[model samples]
Target: MKKFTFKIFAVAITLLLSTSLSLELLAQSAGYEVLFDGGSLEKWRSKSTPSSPIKGWKVEDGMLFMEGEGGGDIITKDKYGDFELVFEFNLTEKANSGIKYFVDTIYNEKSGEMKVNGPEYQIIDDYNYEGVKEDPNGTTSTGAAYLFYPPKNKQLNPHGEWNKGKIVAKGKKVSHWLNGKKLVSYTRGSKDYLKKKTANKFKDDKNYGELKEGHILITDHGDKVFFRNIKIKKL
Candidate 1:
């Protein structure tokens, strides 16, 4: 009886280990890479100084958060061309931030400013933020393509709550999703895209929205925001 019991327990343990290993392998086979799992910043760097360690962002209680000013922005050290990115964020009152993809540094000759330009997945306190409240359904609202396209059918969670954000970029097409619902979708450099691009703050940036391999960035808009479960899969 003792020998039989021991055999049964060993088999159970082996099966458990096999199941866990199978799940992990499945995740990898699907091409998913975890950018942040609350532990290290090995995959990220400060945007301003790519060679240096990140500032203003910290890992606390399994979340990556911006604590104060002068943190600038942070971007992935590895650039991606076509991928699906997902993350969860929590916002403080009136907080403003964004996740930007296809990000690249550009020298704006017209304004004489060096800027990191990309289409932003706008995140803000939609009900309380003055800018968003003024134009609740406008291009600057949460889930917007940041001055390019306004999200439709958005169901934003209230301030101090968590929200899920997803971005899928493949070829010249990109889509933004909030809470598992698609909010914005557009093709870069399309006729309609060009029309909007020429009329916005990025008009002077002739290369803005052009498809290219670029880094993913988390903006530091001088507000408190938390992000976690950041993952990406190349498609």
Candidate 2:
């Protein structure tokens, strides 16, 4: 009788551990998909020419590093309507780059030129950037919503250190996070959003921020920047 009781207890403990492990794995991969896992660009391509091979992006030391001169912006082939994106980036001094979403490709009939337009999450060496240097509070600094909404509380790491970023968009509501801190949150298509859009360069484009579903973009601003751990979860 004693041996049978011990055997039953051991089986129960084993089952419990197995169940817990399964739950943990499920939680980790519930709805998330790894876009770039430091292997290849299977899920990305040059936004300029989606069918052609990527021009200047490279995988180096397990990170997606871009030289920015010849490497144009890369965009995900899949379009996201409402989702959450997370990535890590490290910048060089005086570098300027951005993670742009809600990007819609448009062609101007008059000029016969194609353009990619969206709101940018600014990434730069704020202190060294000449355009934003005068603004001591970092209105256009790292993590700002480009020209539309400036980050009020931003914590940027040193030039070489990695910084975590998150962008969550559901319906018209959007939020930007840097290093686990919420920097900006606003509702798109709202009265304030329209007013702000009209004040920027995007004012000339009617369909700039009105896209319901569009591609995610990593802009190459002629600066050296490294990015990794790019993942997204659709809501």
Candidate 3:
């Protein structure tokens, strides 16, 4: 069946020309709640480079939007173990963005600080990002494990409009979807997820996606990325 989804951060917000759904209300008992309410930032934090937090996100037209460049990583102040996240996103021609969960940002030996390990729900310009130019890296694709798992289809929508995204994280299992298409699914810390990790550049990072609980993060990779209707139902 054809399907589509979006994110409804921890808070609630309404928008013009927006399609409303109860991904949150429907999942109320399931621990579902809004993350972005078009209000001030309370349960959120930002880290532009490494652990250095920056400001670049705001709410507009009922949607949580990342304004003019330079802003860094904006993440939820709270942490979670198991949950379902749904958000709506739209980008510029070559816009780059993504939602990351199960994040355990810690310091590395060699590097002063970094997002040590966490499973990220892939998002990007599929066909228009800078990767399609300069240096081609699978990590920049719309639905790849950011260089681990590569999405087969170019189902990503064109920049300037909205595209639905979903992330399901329960225990050792994780899944990603874009525009209602399955991009990747694997059990966290599982042999399968571990196998792929071992084969990729993340092999050395034992902490990668190993978190049994962590916070949510939104990456402001220097491009325009808008999000809204962010809701999460914790399992």
Best by lDDT: 1
TM-score ranking, best first = 1, 2, 3
* lDDT of all predictions: 0.86, 0.83, 0.70
Model 3 quality (TM-score)? 0.76
TM-score for each predicted model, relative to the true structure: 0.85, 0.84, 0.76
Summarize candidate 2's per-residue lDDT along 1-235 as a digit string, tens digits. Answer: 9999999999998976565345435545777777876667889988767678898888876589885468788889888989999999998888888999999766678886558977788898886778778765465789988888888677889789999999999988899999999999988889999998888778887777678889999988788888987888898
| Residue 189, model 3: Cα distance from true site in angstroms | 2.3
How many clashes show up in model 3?
Answer: 29
User: Ten consecutive residues with minimal summed lDDT in candidate 1?
Assistant: 18-27
Rank candidates, lDDT, best first: 1, 2, 3
In model 3, the Cα lDDT at residue 217 comes to 89
Q: Give the residue spans of candidate 1 off by over 4 A.
A: 1-29, 106-114
State each model's C-alpha RMSD to the native: 5.4, 8.1, 8.6
- Model 3, 1-235: lDDT tens digits are 1232233421223532232334434546466777874444555777424335446777666667678766677778778888888888887777777787778667566865555356666676766666645535555577666656665554877888788888888778777888888877767776767777888787898877877788888877777777876777777
Quote the lDDT for 128 in model 2.
Answer: 78
Name the candidate, 2 or 3, with the larger lDDT value. 2
